[model samples]
Target: MTLVIGLVVHRSHHRLFQEAARTLTGVRLEWVDYEAEDEIRARTAGLLDRQRLDGLLLGPVPYARCRDLLPPDLPVTVTRSAGLDLALAWCRALARGWPATPVSIDTFDQETVDEVAAALDLDRERIACLPFDPDQPVAEIVEFHRRFLDRFGGRYVISVRTGVVAAFAGAVPVLSGLAGLGTIRAELHELALRSQSKRASERRFAAGVFLIAKPERSANLDRARIGLMNMLLNTPEYADGWIEDRGRRGVIVFAHQALFEAVTHNWVSLPVLAQAQDTLGVRVVAGFGVGPSARTCVALAERAANRAEQDDSPGAYLIEESGVMIGPMGPAGHPLHFTYRAHGAGIERLAERVGLSPATLSRLAAVERGLDGQAVSPSDLAGSLGITDPSGRRLIRKLSESGLVIPEGSAQVNRKGRPSRLYRLGIGAALAAGATAPAGPGDAAGGDGGRDGDGPVDGGRRDG
Candidate 1:
């Protein structure tokens, strides 16, 4: 039987190690709160001197510091991030079974070299650290990742930011540094211990909240719609809040169905529910999708969240798979299906045309593809009308005056903030509804107008 010793540098980590120590038949977990560098190496040596001890496990920090004192004669294992020769050496020691517990410390610096060095300690020159700068941006990070993959022939990165993820594709699988089904629980032990000693650490948590409801009356619809809008905008106005709310720019509050309900029939307000870490607060960005199916509706809302965060129009933020303001309005009560059929073809057309919001393109594509006028909410018409986020109402007013789209019903004015406008289809809607032939010669057709213009996709303009 082997005797294992776990050198816990922090007392708070005891419970975790005690449980893990049970996995090894003869392993014994112990602690030494090393406040100094010498203490770290001394404690490690003391454990190594124990003849019955078969292996050693070192804490991340202390193991990293006193790596030289760790014995080649003992089986050693260290706790740390990947990419270190010192770690591999300690692991090798443990794999072979040792005279004492193996101690190792892991550090971010020269991890690749450290791991390679331990594995090929016999040939120092051949063990080298690969090129990398921790502060590189997304593009540079991607390049670094590619180089790493090429160097190792088969390797994966532990963590990556959102930007580079789309570029890496299948070249590698993304893995978080944290692992284990009960890892959160285990990490909590370390965190609590560190906290007791007054250590500073960033918060690690996220949360989501969803508000659901149907409008019963125009007043209820007004309150509920404004309520939702106020909720989304609330976050940016405050230092901290439940939601990292998006969709504040092109918010959809009172709309056709909502107006009808408020003015005519009554509807129920759905409850709001959320889930997240106790430490982390929740943030929300409301999304609205118009469709016959619940699936499409939810999809629209999800898109709303995306657009809001990116500072985009809610219409462009979601998915629509039905009739368009620019195209033929689907039969009432069946907008979802019409949108679905027209959405893809519209997107392709949009790539060629440019300037139109996804909503505007959607509406225009619908019209060009079909015969009758499709549904054109103020928001949909605004998208089809190519109104920038700040101009949702102005575009609606312009289209209404131009005779492109029409409001489904009356809308309340918000004098305290931006004035709320109603939807009305007119000539603008017709132009959107009609499959516009490529504009003759040079009418500024698909010209450099708004974001994602002839301008760069990643740089200025598009970010908004």
Candidate 2:
């Protein structure tokens, strides 16, 4: 699928951004031009409403300007000049016989101004640094630069902000503080990767194969197939070709893995199927499977369907490629004992006790179940979560901090090199320590394992 990204730019740099976007492949870039920062705020609701956009790029303004305004789930990248770009621009100006003294520079913070001065080996006093708020008006920045030029007698200006550059009006030789093509391309590449990662995390793959027991003379197999297909088509996550008939006695349906997950959380799609079963006076048995590949899903689903057909009761059954069985879902699609169902509430409570959101808790539970109680490395967790390894590491760190998990051992995931550390579920310990405040005495222990008030609180070893 072509990844579509939104590029929000100021009126001034529309051409530049458009040219850059034209060079990208495997991605569609949509440009949304706004006259001012407020315009962006005004249009945020509309921008977010565009469901087709996979990510967003904010131009001119720093991400700080509107980061809080955008949807938290949408990946965003802000165009800003890197330090190397600033250094190069300064070098170019100086090589062109521009005086280094009395240089007026516009930047986002004082720290950057100091870094620029240090990088250029210029006296700090000679560099008139004018700091601007990320959300401030361009006119204010222009006025600040004008005052700096007058007071410091600067003959040259370096500005990364698009708004500040527009106010130049030929008053002084202006050097662009914006990042060069190479840097911009690198940032875009990073953003694209993030967008792809998000999409991967959201993608769900599952398929189900069904077999109908020979029914009374009034029921029709062809009509049942049509009804099943129609039911699947009505759901947003499933579509055409997602369902098909295997034979007069069998049928198949493809869907996102999330469908089964939601069923445990009270989604009533299963009940609709039960109603159909009752109306048709036919016993329907289905087998569901979730896998990374279509072939694997179909194979597992078929195996499950066969198992269901052989069973005495008509229900849904899920079989893992590893041969794990979890079902016997009744006509209403209620699984008697699904792993997710068993751990879901525990995870919710754990999340609350550890100050984590339910979403994170759910993801953690998924990882734990996938590992089958085995210790998992950060990389393994990252793969399961469809996120970067670093993100997985960060999440593991948070879980450890919450006393919900403990480091266990290390294992080599690759052919060569030292093994990576592993962690196991410490839910029992977490529950035991649930009464303790998050900021327990161990907060100042400095990785020293000696701070022990009681049970699980002391179990957090630095390398346990």
Candidate 3:
């Protein structure tokens, strides 16, 4: 298949890019000419709806002017003046017997201007510089150069813009901008590769649902839907290809996998979901599913949505293709956001004694809830805390020192290495009396607190 790349250029540079396109193979270059910023934006928008263009290459001026109007997912290349191009421009000035000092520049950014000044060893204070801004009116730009010429007494103008060149037509000598055809070719090649990659990634199907968990009696569902629309539309990545079902109980969005990755940024956290919930002033449980087929993706998404709705506050969940259930993420504004602190000071004091952060304690406390007052091993705690086993062991040691976890009897398993000992959360009279924890394994003042089992707290390491 031929890779089609669109080029937007001013009329003067039409022959330059057209000639460069002829030297390339395995690609088709589509050229469009524009005289003004608004024209470029309007023409590009129209082209996007009608053309099958893969990527776009625009001059720096056109890019700055028309970028917001283009699709965010589309790969775009903005050509800038660079090394050889700058050298050529400078060589031309020298060939014309132009003086090194008092050269007025109005095209490139500050970095490029500084580089040219340093390369020519010109006096920094004497070189008149103005950074290019495509949005600035032509008259204002003309006046800026007019004042610059008066201030520096410059006899020549150096720029890449045709407008700037026309503005100085009869007043002074104008030099072409630094960037050449070679730079444009290289940038277009890179943009084509990026466009191909994005196109491949978009082939996968993905879907997600946001279920409102019984809205408050006083809340306005209309206002909530408006907030939802605003949030989704403002985030450009998820805005496209979305089919939203704004039902009374939920909002289901079916979109491309690219949007899912953009919304989550491929992270395990729930910041976006929490932000949505807060912005809408409602409890929203979301579930996302990604798969090869839209039907399969929607089914998995429905399962995840059900899991999220079962939770008290808003949650975001994901079901991967490998059948792994990912989350029931916490809503940031929920009243019981921290489950460890939900019961009040006792757990907070216990967390402080064990030298654990409140967030970690909250997660660990959640694991304890599933066990119904049972002990948790380092591996189990690590799994719950999403940390490594070594880190979990370190935490267990700290808790042991704080008299919060007491070692029980050790038991052998399948004649393996040393027997893994049992441990439990010691919150009875011994803890109340402020007794110190055992110094090491087997130094605790008790027998086995409970028998070993395959539960979250028992199968792995010893408590102490």
Query: In terms of lDDT, which candidate is strongest?
Result: 3
Off by over 4 Å in 1: 35-38, 50-52, 82-464
lDDT of 1 by residue, 167-224 (tens): 6568654333212214323443443344322211112111122332222322433443
Put down candidate 3 lDDT per residue, 337-449, tens digits, no spaces.
22322333444456566666433443444344333333445665565444578877876787679765667444333244665554565444332343343233332211221
Q: RMSD to the native, candidate 3?
A: 24.9
Structural similarity to truth (TM-score) of each candidate: 0.20, 0.49, 0.48
Model 2, stretches more than 4 Å misplaced? 42-51, 60-69, 108-111, 130-132, 207-237, 240-253, 257-464
Candidate 2 lDDT by residue in tens digits, 321-407: 667777666665443222212232453467666765543453355445433345667876765545677877887888888766778
TM-score of structure candidate 1? 0.20
Sliding window of 10 residues with minimal summed lDDT for model 3: 445-454
Q: What is the C-alpha local distance difference test score of candidate 3?
A: 0.63
**Candidate 3 runs further than 4 Å off:** 23-26, 36-38, 204-464
Per model, state how many residue pairs clash.
70, 0, 0
